[model samples]
Target: MRQPSRQGVEQALDRVMRVVTRTPLLPMGHGGAQAWIKAESLQRGGAFKLRGAYNRMVQIAPEDRPRGVVAFSSGNHAQGVARAARLLEMPAIIVMPADAPAVKLAGTRALGAEIVTYDRATESREAIAADLAARRGAVLVPSFDDVDVVEGQGTAGLEIAAALGHVPARVIVPCGGGGLAAGIALALPDAEIVVVEPEGWDDMRRSLELGHIVEVPADAPPTACDALQSRRVADITFGALHAAGARGVAVSEAEIRAAMRFAFAHGLVVEPGGAVALAAWLAGRLTDDGAETVIVCSGSNIDPAAFAAVLQEEK
Candidate 1:
């Protein structure tokens, strides 16, 4: 498929609004800087994944609807595709990490999708999902690599810009496989796109810096941000981000925890992966660049015990 464009994103916004919630743009400030939070954490399915999932699944050929679809996700995207498929009255199968968050796994099951668990350390979710799709003659809806999905995610940027009456000076998004960042970059050409990833999973960051794709280190350390654990970015996403002149930052575990706590204090509940952009901002990793920035708080489906511990750690 072709790279997502502004027109494609506009079309996606129209379709996505039919099913997804238009999350609000909230104002927040720290030190001398002010920002608008694109609170996608409030979206249906508890994350922005619903936008892309619905947009892609809804467009499946009417004749092929009975065949359903297959996907792979650690959490958020699983819920997205499952929920969408449920709404479409189609069967859905999700290949998920065996150790994925309980809340996420429960959410996917609740949405009526079959769950196929795999060992993240040993098994390839892609290979498994592909095989399932081939076996069932089902459509494979990629989490980030597909053009339709990218366009759907970009609707967030459209909403943000429309709310602000113009493109903000900057937009910071949490990155996994670079879908959201790439989409936002296309949506707001005038704004600087800043992608934030967990420290050890900063393949996109390094890839951008090195001007080529880079896979996550084989011995990468554990991270709480399971939703952002993409091993590498697809060429489609990287091409859009690179063309948009995007920048990147990596957030530490402590920083992500602090951001989660900070968001909670502000009456927003954010997952570890979802809070990375805000984490970078809170940790002073993002300098005062004189831009009216917008940070995407991407998801909210965090496990209760883990959230409580992060909040308690500071107290």
Candidate 2:
């Protein structure tokens, strides 16, 4: 597949803006440091996934739409595809991990998509989704690997630049399969890209450091960032980020929880996965040289109980 381009991202922005919400770019200051938060957590479907999902589904050929679409995601992407399919009047089947948070499962189901659950530790979600799509003659919409999806996700970067009136010196994005980071890199070519991931599942970080794709360790510790738990980094996403000279950092569970609290204190709701970028920033993993910076608050789909518990933790 061809690599996504800025032109492709621009085209995707035009297509997605009609459906995706233009989330806010809020200013945040810590001590003497100032940064802007791209509040994608406030986006429709409670995440930025909708931008790419809608962008991809909207392009399905008319005749092909009848076959519908199939996808695999822990939760955010499932809801994204489900919402997009509903908007486009297409059937959607989502293969999700059985252990995904109840809120995410319920959210996706509420959007009217058929759900297929599998064991994340023992089964491959990609295999299941691909098989289901092949059998049903439906389109397989990957969470982050497709060119259109990457371009669609890039629309967020476009919005960031447009809001700032110039490219920020840097952008910190949470890394899952690297779609958001890659997309933003393409969108803000002049800015430095930094990806943040959960400590045990920092495959993208390791891949960037090693100059090759790397898979998360088989015995990786469990993390609360379910949305950022891709076992391997995809070539498409890695390629885009590597070319953009992106760097990465991994944050601990404690740091993620703290970041969530920080966001809440600021009147924003952030999921664990979505809070990693902010965690990195708050933990001093990334320096603030007074250069303009943007940190993406990617999602806000945590269950009420889970979010409450995190908020109650001591700082």
Candidate 3:
């Protein structure tokens, strides 16, 4: 797989920033380290997924646009793809886990995308989506595996670097399939990249350590981070992250909940998956290396009741 480059990222920024918001960088002090939170939680579709989805959609051949596109995501990418397809006046079909958050499912439907639900524990969303696309003559869009998607995600790094006026010493990103982290690593070659994940679904962390792809344990406990529940990391994304010498960390559910509460205290609405980077930092899992750090608060697509319950938990 070809590693995403800064040039590709620059092009992606040129294409994506025109449609997506340049999400803000909020300054803060975290664990005695000077930090900035890249608030992608406020992005279109309530996550950073829109950048890649739109980037890919806009480039599809005019003839291919009639055939439409297909994708699989728990929620964020589903919304991203759905919203992008809606904007492009193209049909979109999303294969989602039946157990996905209600807000995500409804959001995808609201955007006029056809939804197909499968058993997360017993069925493969990728296989189902691929089959659907093949049958319909539609383009299959991988959430984090494709070159265009990765480059689009890299635009976030471009925005971050431009805002900071330089590549920060460290970039902490929440990882599911590794696209965002991989893209950031490519975009900011001089910075240390740290990918954070929920404990039970830390395949990306293990994959980075083992120097190979590793699937999440089949019996892994249910997690609130539906967006970060990728069973395995893709070769393209893992390759970029590996080449960048990126590091990884996993945080417990308790830590994730705490991070959500912390975000709430800061007047930010962050989904569980999106809070992993902050969770890792708050739990002391990441070393305070005195680097000017940017923590990617990746998304905010939680159901209101679910988010409220999480916030009500006592520390």
Candidate 4:
């Protein structure tokens, strides 16, 4: 069977629109240049992950649905997959890092997914998820590397272009596994793509520099946001980034906290990982290249305590 394409991603915008909210494209007037933000944090389950999760879930073979589904996520992906599976009435087993945010861990459970937590500093979530799939006979849904997932994520780009009514000169996306940025880059080849990462979780940055996916240490002297916790780079996203001539930037955790405070002051609620792109903008990471810019506002599943603690620590 033929795989889904860019056109399919476009059509899915309409299909998903019925279930998922058509998040707004608002201007980042605070930052110079015509920066429009794709507020994906407003999606169901508090992140854009739901878009791909539902798009991919709704298309699963009916015969294959009974075997159930399995996935590994740090936070947003787990919640998105769990929520999508619940809607389909399929059993879901989600593997998460033991250090996953309380909000994400609880959110996935609330969505009725069975929880399997592993050591983040030592264990491999891939191995855990793979084993879960083998034992349960479930389909493993990779957070960002699968075509279905990538196609689903591309819908964000489609909507951004449509909403903006024209292609932008540049687009900024926060990178964890690089799926979101890759999806946008794939869909909008006409635009320049830059990835903003928490200073330490710069996997894509280091990966592109090395010309291959390389593992980056998580606690290698940690700073910056939560939810940017990723250890591997994905081929699915790397291909898109390379094709789009993408660049990378790193933002300090202090800068991210300042940006986060600015967002909250402006009535925007964004998690640390999701706020990296905006944080990059606030830190003056881009030039006014006459390119209409769009930043992916990806998620908002915040742990109440961490939120308060970060605010206090930053203060």
Ten contiguous residues minimizing lDDT sum, candidate 1: 306-315
Pitting candidate 3 against candidate 4, the one with the higher lDDT is 3
TM-score versus the correct structure, for each prediction = 0.99, 0.99, 0.98, 0.93
Question: What digit string (tens of lDDT, one per residue) describes model 3 on residues 105-194?
Answer: 999999999999999888988889989999999999899999999999999998999998999999999999988998899899999999
Worst 10 residues of 4 by lDDT: 1-10
lDDT of 2 by residue, 221-288 (tens): 98999999898988999999999999999999999999999999999999999999999999989876
lDDT agreement with native, every candidate: 0.93, 0.95, 0.92, 0.82
What residue pairs are clashing in model 4? 169-291, 169-292
Q: Of models 2 and 4, which has the larger TM-score?
A: 2
Error of 1 at 300 (Å): 0.4
Residue lDDT tens for model 4, 1-315? 334456767766765676777789987677345578888888888998987888888888898898889999888999989988988888999999887888889899999999999987778889999998998889999888787787778888888888878888888999988878887887787888999888767879887776777777745657545566777777768877876789889989888877777777767788888889988988888876666778887888888887776667645
Clashing pairs in 1: none
Candidate 1 residue lDDT tens string, 78-149:
999999998899999999999999999999999999999999999999999999999999999999999999
